[model samples]
Target: MAAKPRVATCSLTGCFGCHMSLLDIDERIIDLIGLVDFDKSPIDDIKSFTGPVDVGIIEGGVSNDENVEVLRSFREHCGVLVAVGECALTGGVPSMRNLVPLKECLEEAYLKGPTLVGGAIPNDPEIPLLLDRVYPCHEVVRIDYMLPGCPPSADVLWTALAALLKGEEPKLGYELIKYD
Candidate 1:
C-alpha cells in the first residue's frame, strides 16, 4: 500500500476558530486520520515537527516574533503550506491595530486599559516581541493555498484537506464559502 500523506497545523495570532472548525468535522476525522499522519499539530498537541510534512495548514496572521519563527519553520518543513481563515489571508480582526501606532496599542493594552488597577507593559524576555503591525501569512512567506473565512466552515476545511491529500486543488463552490 502507498504511504499516507503527512500533515501538520498551527495557529498564530487569531482566535483559533479555524482549528475549532477542524474539530467540528467530528466523525470524518477518523477518515482523515486514515489518510494522513499528523505532525506538529495542536490536534495531537505535538510541539515540534518530527519530519517533513506533505501539507502544513496554518491559521491566523503573523503578529509577533514567535509567530514568525513558527511560520518560517512550517515553510521549511512542509512541501505545501496552506493559510486558513480571514486572519491568515488578510490579518482579519487583529488588523484593526494597523490603524493605530503600535506603541499606543501596547500602552492601551498593558498600561491604560479600563480593566486594570495597576499594570505595567510587559518587558520580559520570555514574551515574544510584537511586530509593528499584523501581517497576513502570504506577506511573510509563500502560501500554496488560502481559505478565506472568519473560520472556514468544517466542510470547506474537509474538502480542502481531502483534495490536497489526493494531490488535487481544492475547488470550493459558492455554497461552501461562509463568513459565519
Candidate 2:
C-alpha cells in the first residue's frame, strides 16, 4: 500500500476565517485525515515545514517581508500550491490599505489613532516590515489553484481537496464559488 499524500496549510495576512471554514467541514475532517497526512498546519500547530509537501493550502494575502519569504518557501517545497479564500486570491479586505499610503496607514494605526496616548510607529528589529501593498499569493509565488470566497465554504474546500487527491480537476459548481 502507498502512503497518504502530504498536505500542509499556512495563514499569512488575513483573519483566520478560512482555516475556521476548513474546520466547518466538521466531522468530515476525519475523512480528510484518512486521505491525506497533514504536515505543517495551524490545526497541527507545526511551526516549520518538515518535508516536501504534496499540497500547500495558503489562506491569506502577502502583506509583509515575512509573508513573502514564507510564500516563496511554500512554492519551493510544495508540488501543488493552492491559494484559498478571497484574501489569498485577491488580497481581499487587507488590500483596502492599498488605497492609502503605507506610511499614513501605519501612522493612523500606531501614532495618530485616538486609541493612543503616546504611541509611536513601532520600529523594532523583531517586527516584520510591512510591504507597500497587500498582494495575492500568486503575486508572491506561483499558485497551482485558487479557491475564491471571503472564506470558501466547507463544501468547496472538501470538493476541491477530494478531486485534487484523486488527481482530477476540481469541478466546482457555480454556487460553490463566490466573491464578496
Candidate 3:
C-alpha cells in the first residue's frame, strides 16, 4: 500500500490557540489522522525526530533566533509549508507590543517594580532579539499556504483542507471566507 502524506506542525511564540483549533477538528481530525501521518507536531507522541516532513504548519511570528531555526528547518523538511494564524501570518498580538522598546517591555515584565531580578533578557546573546515589526511567513521564506486570522475560523480551515485533500484549488486565488 502507498504511504499516507506526512504533516508536521509546531507553534512558535503564540498563544497556542491554533493547535487547539486543530484538536478541535473533532472527527475530521480522526479522519485526517488516517489520511496523513503526523511527524513532529508540538503534540507529538514522540519526543524528538529527524526525518523529512511533508507539510509544515507554523503558528506564530519569528521573534528570535530559535524562531529562525524553526522556520528554516520546517521549510527544509516540508514539501508544502503553511503558516497558520495571525501570529504566523503577521506576528499577531505579540508584535503589537513592538510599539514599545524591547528594554521597556523587558523592564515592564521583569526589571522594574514587581519584576524578576537577575533577569536573563530574551534578546541578549543567549537569547534572541525581535525585529522592529511583525511580518508574515512569506516575508521570511516561500510559503505554499497561508491561513490568516487572529485565529482563523474553523469553517474556513475545514473547507481549505477538504480542497487540499481532494487535490483541488484551496482558496488560493479566491476568497473562501470574508475578512474585515
Most accurate candidate by TM-score: 2
Model 1 — TM-score against the truth? 0.95
* Better by TM-score, candidate 2 or 1: 2
lDDT of 3 by residue, 74-142 (tens): 899888788888888878888888788866876777656464667654545776666665665777888
Tens-digit per-residue lDDT, 1-180, candidate 1: 987889999999989899999989999998988888999998899999999999999999999999999999999999999999999999999988999999999899988989998989998999999999999999999999988788999999999999998889998999887655
For model 3, the stretches where C-alpha displacement exceeds 4 angstroms are 45-49, 114-134, 172-180
- Return the TM-score for each candidate structure: 0.95, 0.97, 0.83
Best lDDT among the predictions, by candidate number: 1
- Reference-based TM-score, model 3: 0.83
lDDT of each: 0.93, 0.92, 0.74
State each candidate's clash count: 0, 0, 0
- The C-alpha stretches of model 2 lying farther than 4 A from their native spots are none
Off by over 4 Å in 1: none
lDDT, model 1: 0.93
Residue-level lDDT for 155 in candidate 2: 93
As a whole number from 0 to 100, the lDDT of residue 19 in candidate 3 is 82
